[model samples]
Target: MVLFQEGLRIKMKDLQNTLEDYEQVKLSCDHTAEYIKVQSNNTEKQIKEDFEKLHQFLRDEEAARISALWKEEGQKSRMMKEKIEQMVREISSLSDSIRVVKEKMGADDVSLLQNYKSTLERAQCALQNPERVSGALINVAKHLGNLKFRVWEKM
Candidate 1:
């Protein structure tokens, strides 16, 4: 009977040890699951931050391009304005010369002859013919050519 008791005690101890081992395995599984969850969240955060940087880069690129476009527009506008102002001055000068000649024509013969050379020179303006301004507009091709490809390449 004592032998039977001894066997029973040993069996009980073995079962307890098994139970403890099972509990340890369960704890390890839970820990592994929590670690995986934490790691996944960290990876997702890193990816989001990377994308935000990309978006910021694109925004900065867009701002720079738009600023350049505006600068080009202002430069071209100023050039055209200067050309137009020059043409207007030339026209005003021509009109003044015509008026002087007409007034001289109304004068008496001796007075007209006295200023004939000066009047003729006034009639012959030294201005050259206005030439067309080449490359006066914004170069759209420089801004827009292969836009997506260029951006991707830059990125």
Candidate 2:
């Protein structure tokens, strides 16, 4: 009966060691799970932050392009205005010359004919080649190709 008790003690100790090993494995598993959860959360936060930065970058780029477009439009408008003023001045000059010619109806035929020929030539030139003042065309799609590539690289 004492030998049986000694054998029982050895079995109990072995079971205890096995239980301790099992507890250690469970603890390690729990720690690994927690570590994975923290890493996952961190990765998600990093992705969100990157997306925010990318969105802001897009906004800034859009604003800059819009500003440039507006500036170009303003310049085009000013240039058109200047061209119109020049044309108006030219028309006024022609009108004044016509009035002078009418008043000098008794002037030499050669002088009047020469003046009319010069005026006709000027009018023809103006008609054939009009002043081309068009607004700037903002190409929004021009940057889209590079934009996709850049966004993909960020991802």
- Name the top TM-score candidate: 1
lDDT string for model 2 (1-155, tens) is 99999999999999999999999999999999999999999999999999999899878777866686678667767777788898888777777766665655556878667677665554443433445655444444654548657655655
lDDT of 1 by residue, 14-75 (tens): 99999999999999999999999999999999999999999998998888888989999999
Candidate 1 structure lDDT: 0.92
The stretch of ten residues in a row with the least summed lDDT in candidate 2 is: 121-130
Best by lDDT: 1
> 143 in model 1: Cα distance from truth in Å?
1.1
In order of appearance, the predictions have TM-scores of 0.69, 0.57
The Cα local distance difference test for each model comes to 0.92, 0.74
Model 1 worst lDDT run, 10 consecutive residues:
142-151
The alpha-carbon deviation from the true structure for residue 144 of candidate 1, after best TM-score superposition, in angstroms, is 1.5
